[model samples]
Target: MHGLVNRALQEFVKDTYGADIWGEVRDQAALPFDEFESMLHYDIRLTKLTIDAASAVLHKDAASLLEDVGSWLVSNPAQESIRRLLRFGGTTFLDFLQSLEELPGRARMALPDLDMPEIVLQTDTPGRFKLEIRWALDGMGSVLLGALRGMADDYGALVVLEAEPGREGAEIVVIDLLDAQFAAGRTFELDAQMR
Candidate 1:
C-alpha cells in the first residue's frame, strides 16, 4: 500500500477525531512508527490494521468510517487540492460522472507511485449509473460513496448513492441523479481567490 493512502487515513483521524484519538488508534494498531512516510510503501495489512483500530477506537463501523474518510478527501478544507483535482473532471455533475474513468490514469501521471483501483462506470439508463470499483482493499466503495455524495453537493446535484457488497475485495456503488442542477454549488475558481 502507498504510504500516502495510509497517511490520508491518518490525517483524517487526526483532523476529524483529534490527535489523541490518532494516538490511541496507533497504539491499538500496534504500529511501530508514529507517522506514515508519505513517499514510502507499507504492507497492505498496515492499512487494514489502522482502519480496524480506528474503527474500534471511534466505535464506528469500518465501512462507515472509510466513507467519512472518503468524504473528507474531497470535502475537507485541508483536502482542497483533491477537491480541485476532482472538480477539474467536469464543469457539471454529469461530466464528472463520465470522467471518472480518467481519474486513475491522471493520478498516476501526477504521482507515479500512487497506484489506485480501476473504476468501471455503467449507465443503467438516463440519470442512473452503476460503479464497479476494483479495489484490492475493502471499503473503497464506501469511500467512493462518500466522495460521490460530497461531489454531488459540490456540483449542486441531488443524488442517491449506496454501497453494495461485491465479490471479495470489491465494491459496487449505485448512483441515481435526481437533479443535475439542484442549486448553485460552492464557487471554484482557476486561481486562488481570483475574484
Candidate 2:
C-alpha cells in the first residue's frame, strides 16, 4: 500500500474522531510511527492493522469505516488535490465513470511505485454500467462504493449502485443512472397529435 493511503486514513480518523482516538488506535495497531509520510510505500499489513484497530476502538464495522474514508477523500476540502485529480476525468457523471478505467495508468504516472487496483467498466445497457475491481488487499470494495457515491454527489447526478459478489479478490459493482436530467434540473414533456 502507499503511504498516502495510510496518511489519509490517519487524517480521517483524527479529523472525524479526534487526535486522541487516533493515538489510541495507532498504539492498538502496534504501529511504531505516529505519522505516515506520503509518497512512500508501506507494508499493506500495516494498513489492515490500522483499520482493524480503528474498528475496535470506534465500534464501527470495518467496511463502514472504509466507506466513510472513501467518501471523505472525495468530499473533504482538505483533500482537494485528490478531488481535482478525479474531476479532471470528466465534465459529467458518465464521463467520470468511463474515465475510471484509465485511473490506474494516470496514478502510475504520478507515483511510479504505487500499484493501483484495476478498475474495469462495462456497459450493460444505456444508462447502466458494471464496474469490476481487482485488488490484492481486502476492504477496498466498500471504499470504492463510497467513492463512487461521492463522485455522483459531486456531479449532482442521481445514481443507484449495487454490489454483486465476484470471484476471489474481485468486486463487481453495478451502477444505474436514474435521471440524466436531474443533475441539470430539467424536465421532459410529451406532445400528442389527433387525427
TM values, all candidates: 0.96, 0.90
Candidate 1 segments whose C-alpha is farther than 4 A from its true place:
192-195
Judging by TM-score against the true structure, name the best candidate: 1
lDDT tens per residue, model 1, 1-195: 999999999999999989999999999999999999889999999999999999999999998999999899999988898998898899999999999989899899888878588899999999999998987688888888999999999999999998877766668999999999999998778776653
Model 2 lDDT on a 0 to 1 scale: 0.83
Give the TM-score (vs. native) of candidate 2.
Answer: 0.90
> What are the clashing pairs of model 2?
none
Looking at model 2, residue 128 earns an lDDT score of 92
- Candidate 2 C-alpha lDDT tens digits along 41-106: 889899989999999999999988988998899888787667677877877788889999998899
| Pairs clashing within candidate 1 | none
Worst 10 residues of 1 by lDDT: 186-195
